[model samples]
Target: MPNVVEPKLIAGNANQPLASAITRRMSIHRGVHIDLVDARVERFNDGEIFVEVFENVRGEDMFIIQSTSNPANDNLMELLIMADALRRSSASRVTAVIPYFGYARQDRRTKPRTPITAKLVANMLVESGISRVLTMDLHAAQIQGFFDIPVDNLYASPIFALDIREKFKDRMDEIMVVSPDVGGVARARELAKRINAPLSIVDKRREKPGEVAEMTVIGEVKDKICVMIDDMCDTAGTLCKAAELLLDYGAKEVHAYVTHGVLSGPAVERISNSVLKNLVITDTIAAPEPVKGCEQIRILPTAPLFAQAILNIWNGTSVSSLFETSTMEPIYEGVFRS
Candidate 1:
């Protein structure tokens, strides 16, 4: 909290509770003369999005909190409009604090005639007057290059590591950390090293979207408790399929730790019906109703980590130290259903 400038924070409709939580950790409260420029969004009969911000924001350091989650286009548009409004109102600077940056997976052209949607989103933000962006665990680390402005890509690993230590204390040898896809091996490997466990990979091939066939396992997983780790879980296709495959490969139990829970389409039903014992996701995006009701799924808040990061940035302190390997003893054993 050193040299704090008391930057003005604003919230959008995407995930107000998360915004409020982050604010509380930063010692800012609601209704403390905070101005909310009304984002009057209306949908036309044709299902189009319209947005208007109704407050004058002259010379303020504006931080707009909006996550590009479900209805990705609408939420994205809302953030853009809010930035435009603040820009025209003479706001000194505008920072878009999007915890769950949507369209991040489309970081590059995997096939012919495919658009790099992540770059497009970055361009849109820049065009809409966003001076900077603060987000976490992007689908691809290289996506940061898409933005010309300063983009702070925070890590939820510290938060996830803390929870893991508390949940799996001893019997670490019985556990194996898994990356559901080859692209995520680094992420899973890091978590595995932190927990003093072996790393495993699910070598799967996708024939098309939302369909995966697990071909092989890359590590020793027989009769061991497995924990799959990923940046996000959207349709639950990859995670669920990996879990089932792990079980078939003699994994005693399977759990997954994903940062963003986009839980779109039949994701909830898929996870519920899969072989997963538990699915832990961070509150980057507000989880939908069916996802919340799923018995095997649990949500942990990331407000503390983000709040601390904000404080560090405001005070010109280093946040890289937060990712240091944990020295604490482990906490849970065996796979947990919740």
Candidate 2:
């Protein structure tokens, strides 16, 4: 934790909207005294990157806001350069604020001769002089352990859980939270416990990235409202396929609640045609225009949560209460549907 006064915020080209939202929530008037350096980035013909940060960050607490999402290599290079610049300018401390950490899904090597890119990303950050990391809803919790420096892995679940509680309160028993895969069973169970509902798991096999075949469900989802939960939604194949299977298995309705929406290539179209009633995602990573325009997709802001976390960490206060609940509360509490 450090002093809040004069905490300088820098941004790479990735997810500037999130940075701006965070700045707004902090009550810092845009562009008065504080500055957001746009690290100019360029890619060479060989696909190499070049970056330059044009601001002095000496003795200042620098928070670099960058989502290593689309064009991940370029954004990552921009962050590394900004950190290098801050360190060379003798900044007191550097905290890399990556809303959506790329390469997180590659936390483990499932096949022979594959590299663990998540650990490599951690090493790169440390080498870039990032003293600490501030990120949300990492693909794997173990990725935090990859860093020797202090890493703060924040959660968007509290925000989503609260919204779910507020939006769908009348039919608690009808709702069954589901994990799209076995890896997300823990996360889905946590949400189910919070909502005081039963949990289900979708047993699926991945033919390759973005292609999955859901075989069957492990719990009783028939005639129950199903809500699929996962850390990130990449191509949406797994989610959409799971939703289809849930429908085939007699699920009344299917909805998805995911932390990071890395909706690439065919994600939006896939979700558009799938059985999902709605897909709720957090504003950890910037949602493209297609995602925003999709009728079935919704974006929830994490600005308040991140702002509160930053304030708590700065004041040496506990953030324990934020992580306690797992259930989705009904939007209205008093009414009951018989």
Candidate 3:
């Protein structure tokens, strides 16, 4: 057998908790002690970001764990700087483990003279000397093609499927998975198939960014509990509107399972007053105080899933097999229960 190369994990300020969790799971799964790099990220008086990697990463396989979420520009710049620092330090390879790839929604141009910011970000990473990228549940699947390096797009469907099975085990017959919009029908349909539930779609019109117009429920949701699925919930406008429409259509209850809970603007307030029973989201983007304090929200940790993917990548194993939800066991039960 060839020698196994252990990866050096580095954490950025984007989401420290998630980075820590992933580090812990990696150490446990490998049965070997692994530590995150003592990297410091701070800003000078003029607000210029500074990054310093304290450990020697020369000839090492390094993975920088950072999610370009809220304060997207700051976190994104931090990632680029860190990658540059690692590359200059003589690291053999640098893999960016961005759990939540921001600016992914702007993958294409809707109007003339517009920019494809997603592709731009990809170019920036490549120019910064990143060898590969590992991200999850991109807003648009085609965004992977924007990257010149090897990109591994992980899915949150298996994670969500496990939770749905456990939560609605007894009432699976009365459950129906719904797509908040036509674009998310494929995602919702996959979840519905996993749990053996009927699928529904919400036909809605979006006049502009962050605004939803008239919405129409296309399937039979009357008397059935609905599970609305989407890639992300930004302002909650579309989610709230779809929930109200579902309730008006005589749906017994509505719940949501979204990958990224951007929850910007009045999202928390809207969810608090919305007709949904619960809004379940992964810890891709750290939940703010309002989202944490909200009684209607539940957070699921994606660290274990990410940890397994990283391990598979390091071992030259198949990463797609990690999507086998039925065969996989949950590792972060305490965090989810809490």
Candidate 4:
């Protein structure tokens, strides 16, 4: 084989628990041992970010696990700075594992004079000496093109499929996947196919960002257990509205599987009062106290998936297999994107 550097995991202030979990998962593998870098990523008195990596990273393979979630600017800066620090420390290679890539929704120019902030962030990362990127469930699939370095875009579908199979195994006959809006039809469609469930679309018009003017159910959800799917949840206005619409249309029960729970503003309150029976989200974005306390919301783990991906990256093996949900007869087929 070829040479491979000792891989190290570096945690930023973005999400410490996730970084630790990723490290812990990888440690259980036989013949492999990866530990968190002995580093300090802190804020200075003037609110400036400072990074100090105590360990000698010379020629070491590095992976920085940071989610550019809330406090978006701060988290983004921390990632950039950390990558720069690792690069200066002479790390052989640096990969940023950003679970929730912020500014992703701003991928394109929505209007005249508008900035493509996603591309700008990508440019910043490239300039920061980041050699690779691994992120999950980007708001816009095309955003991957913004990066000059190799990008590995992972999905939560496989994990979601397993949970759905277990939760509604007995009610598969009535399961129906509903996209919160027209844009998320593809995601919901894949999940629907995975579970062999019917698909529905919520036809809604957005007058402005975070404000839904109207909502209409586009398919038969009557008496069916509706499961809504989306990439992220910010204010929960559209989600709440769609759930109410489904309930009004005679659906049996409404559930949601959102990847990034950017539950800002009254999102928690809205979910609490909405007709959604349950809201299942991933740990891509760390859940706050209110969100953690919400009875209707549940958080899932993405560490094992990411750990395997990291190992594949380090070993120069195929990472795509980790995405194969129930793709062939060792299980089911077409459950996850091939």
For model 3, what is the error of residue 327's alpha carbon versus the real structure, in angstroms, after optimal superposition?
3.8
Separate clash counts for every candidate: 6, 8, 0, 0
Q: How close is candidate 4 to the true structure, as a TM-score?
A: 0.94
Score each candidate by Cα lDDT.
0.80, 0.80, 0.90, 0.89
Give the higher-TM-score candidate: 3 or 4: 3
Which residue ranges in model 4 land beyond 4 Å of their true spot? 1-5, 31-33, 327-338
lDDT of 4 by residue, 39-116 (tens): 999998999999999999998889999999999999999999999999999999999999999999999988999999
lDDT of 3 by residue, 226-324 (tens): 999999999998898899999999999999999999999999999999898999999999888999999999998898988988888887788888777
- Which candidate has the top score in lDDT? 3
The global Cα lDDT (0 to 1) of model 4 is 0.89
Can you rank all candidates by TM-score, best first? 3, 4, 2, 1
Among these predictions, the greatest TM-score belongs to: 3
| TM-score for all models, in order of appearance | 0.88, 0.88, 0.96, 0.94
Task: lDDT for model 3, please.
Answer: 0.90
> Which tens-of-lDDT digit does each residue in 57-107 have in candidate 2?
667777888999988888888888878878987988988989899999899
lDDT of 1 by residue, 1-338 (tens): 68434666677779988887777766742224333445566667997666666665677667888899987888898888878878887988898889999999899899999999999999999999999888989999999899999888877665666667667766666888999889999998888777788889999887887777446788888999998999998789888878888988999999999999988888899988988999999989987778789999999887766666665655557766555644111211222223
Worst 10-residue lDDT window, candidate 1: 327-336
